[model samples]
Target: MSEEFTYATSEGPNGWTIWQVIGRIDVSTADEAYASGEEIVKGNEKIAIDLSTLEYISSAGLRVILRLNKLAKKSGHKLTVCGAYGMVKSVLKDSGMDVLLAAKESLDELS
Candidate 1:
């Protein structure tokens, strides 16, 4: 069987671009995740990612977000993550990404 990795992009307030990640983010989907993240970074300054629906993630997946954050920071852009819950939240916390990833409990906090 094959697993699918999917994401959606939408515009947010104050010229922010929101990307919603879905499904498992492991080695199987890390490459594609990076490609999509790269595409989102182009021509955008503020980006927010919603991980509310993401079921799982691995180290490879974390690398993708880390790279995206680095690129955004280098360009003077801000990247925020919101809506992380369950194991996804735990993963971010355990990995110390809860600090490094700029994750927010709610988008309202960012506004």
Candidate 2:
């Protein structure tokens, strides 16, 4: 399998933008992940990070998410996480990031 981590953005309902995270986010990619997500949150008022295609995320990845969340809050923007499944979902839940971030089970939940 490929080890590439990339992002795709699309307009979402409820005035939110969907930032789809594909591939893995670990120590090696965490910086890039944060940079990319920071840019997204800066440009949009509402963001929903869709992680359905995400395969893995390390603690570094979680840190990136948390930072983005804080950035959004400080900027008066809204940020939410959605579409997490399997190990990704488990990690978010186990780490309590799910509750802290108010992560949704699916993008539809945000809609």
Question: lDDT per model, in order?
Answer: 0.86, 0.92
Please give the distance, in angstroms, between residue 50's alpha carbon in candidate 1 and its true position after superposition. Answer: 0.6
In model 2, the worst 10-residue window by lDDT is 1-10
TM-score of 1: 0.92
In candidate 1, stretches whose alpha carbon ends up further than 4 angstroms from where it belongs are none
Give the per-residue lDDT digits (tens) of candidate 1, residues 1-111.
227679999888778888889997899999999899888986688889888888988899889899999999988889999999998889889999988878888666666
In model 2, the Cα lDDT at residue 16 comes to 94
User: Which is the leading candidate under lDDT?
Assistant: 2
In model 2, what lDDT does residue 76 have? 98
Q: How many collisions between residues are there in candidate 2?
A: 0
